[model samples]
Target chain A: MDSSQRQLNRSYLLRGLTDGIPIGLVYLAVSFSIGLSARTIGMTGIQGFFMSLTTIASAGEYAGLQVMASNGTMLEMIILTVVTDIRYVLMGCAFSQRFAPNVSLLNRIGTGALITDEIFALQISKSGYIKPFYSYGAALVAVPLWAIGTYLGIIVGNIIPEFLVSALSVSLYGMFIGIIVPPARDNKAIAICIGASFILSWAAEKFLSMLSTGTRIVILIVVIASAISLLFPVADEPAKEAAQNE
Target chain B: MNRITLYIIVMAATTLLVRVIPVLLIRKEIKNRFIKSFLFYVPYVTLAVMTFPTIIECTKSPIAGAAALVGGILAALKKINMFIVAIICCVIVLVLEFVL
Candidate 1:
């Protein structure tokens, strides 16, 4: 390879290492508790690890576990997974745009496999073409971390106190709070959307239990509230400026 | 199908369906200004709805809520990292639960 190409390759590897650390830590913390929760509900360690590897989503995985624990049908689990992960469709689409200019079909598909919300956030913030290898590198580190964390959580869960496990369950919520509150604090429209979805879903769950359609209503609330909020004219100031410059 | 096998199939299919359909449908960059801006805020909204209330109620004591709220606000301002904020909240809850 040429000097510039070699330099690019080196930087990509470094980027992967740096990004992978934080992502892996988050996965360990979050998935560890998820493992405990699954075990608490009677899943074996092998089951939880396989679930994490196949799903790679906290919300969807949790929902699936709830369905399994409740002995809900396979059809219910399938529907829940699809509904909860609808946002990923948009995320993948956006990531693909960033790839379309320079990446080959094989590279795009390969790198796209690793495109989670966190990775998409960091990648989208960067300038210029995305190197597929960097994504592969990040995936190499992150996938193993997720699988290992599940194993560790299951093993550690056997020895940990019940109260401690319960407390750690809150950590997932804590991480989500950390992610959401910062952005919502600055964005009024977004704050409204969040509040609306929560209220609507909460109401549905409480009052619509007799209807035998609680989950679908919750999903509907989220999608409708989010869609309406986006229709409003107020633009995020920083994002507006970024768009203007682009 | 076995439960795990069913899960694997459902998840793989969901991932592929979500990934592929949009890529095929949108032939050009999504230049529609409104849709683009909407997309940007969706995650924030999703996060808030999913996380905010739980932050308030995760502990038995009300004081835990106070600590988490404070830590979350601090983290929001970028005064400290997420680890510090999470630790602050967790410690407060742990200590208070032990004390009370």
Candidate 2:
């Protein structure tokens, strides 16, 4: 290959590696249990790893594993997965808007394949319009971390001590708290957003047990809370700017 | 089809469906203020809604929940590293699970 081509490849690899590191660590912590859970539910190692790779969702994967373990019908799996992952529909909608107009259809679809919560967070943190290649760069890093971690987890799942597994599993929740608590501290409005969404989610699970559609429930709750926030955004922004100036 | 393959298809289809529609339909560069603002906050709401329930569901009993609450408080205060707090909570819960 030409030097220019080699340089391009090297850049892609470096970007993937950098992007993959934190995300890979997270995948290691979360997908380990997912792999372990898949095995406990009678999935072979190959199945478990591929499931993690293809699904790329934590809650959706866990829920999917539960349904499969119970010998849920194909229809049930489809319904439950679609329901559990419907939040992604909204996530995808939001993330896609970040894409510049020039991003191609093929690139959008390909990159959209990798738009999980963590990836979305990381990608959005970078400035300027979101490019399809950047998503690919991130995915090139993240996808394998997820796939490989699951593969290893499945292979050695039975050997790992339960305590260690529990600890690793807790990291998933930790990652969430890490994401939520920081911004939540500075912005009362964001905190309110989190609280309202939490209550709605809890109520949906508890009182609306008849509506066992997890994704739909999340979608509805998010839509409601987001709509409310739109109407009544905390009037502190200009006030804060004024206070800061003073 | 096997269950695994079925799952792959469903996931692939669902993902593509969610992503491709707007890209296809909204050919004009979407500059609508309302749509833009709505998109910005949707992710936070989605993330919080998804995360809150899982923390509760992970803990089997009140003690674990209590420990998690402490861990969560510590995390919120940023008193300790998030990873360390997470491990501490998990260890406390594991011990509680063992003891009670």
Best by lDDT: 2
lDDT of 2 by residue, B1-100 (tens): 6766566566556544654554445445446555655555575576666666656675566566556645765665574544455556667677776777
Worst 10 residues of 2 chain A by lDDT: A237-246
Question: lDDT by residue for model 2 over A1-246, one digit each (tens)?
Answer: 479756764675576567666567768767876787876866777777777777778777787777777877767776777677676666666656666666667767766666777766655444445545556666777777787777777888756665555545555565555555556666666667777877777777777767655654565556765676577453433223212321
Worst 10 residues of 1 chain A by lDDT: A237-246
Evaluate candidate 1 and give its CAPRI docking class based on DockQ: acceptable
lDDT of 1 by residue, A1-246 (tens): 479877886788788767667567767767887787787776667777777776677667777778777878778877877676666676665565555464556766665666665565445434455566677667667767787777677767756554454445445445545555555555566556666766665565567656433244446444754576456644444344333322
lDDT of 2 at A145: 79
The C-alpha TM-scores of every prediction are: 0.71, 0.73
lDDT of 1 by residue, B16-76 (tens): 5665566545546656656666555555554544454555565676566556656655664
**Full-model lDDT, candidate 1:** 0.61
For candidate 1, the share of real interface contacts preserved is 0.28
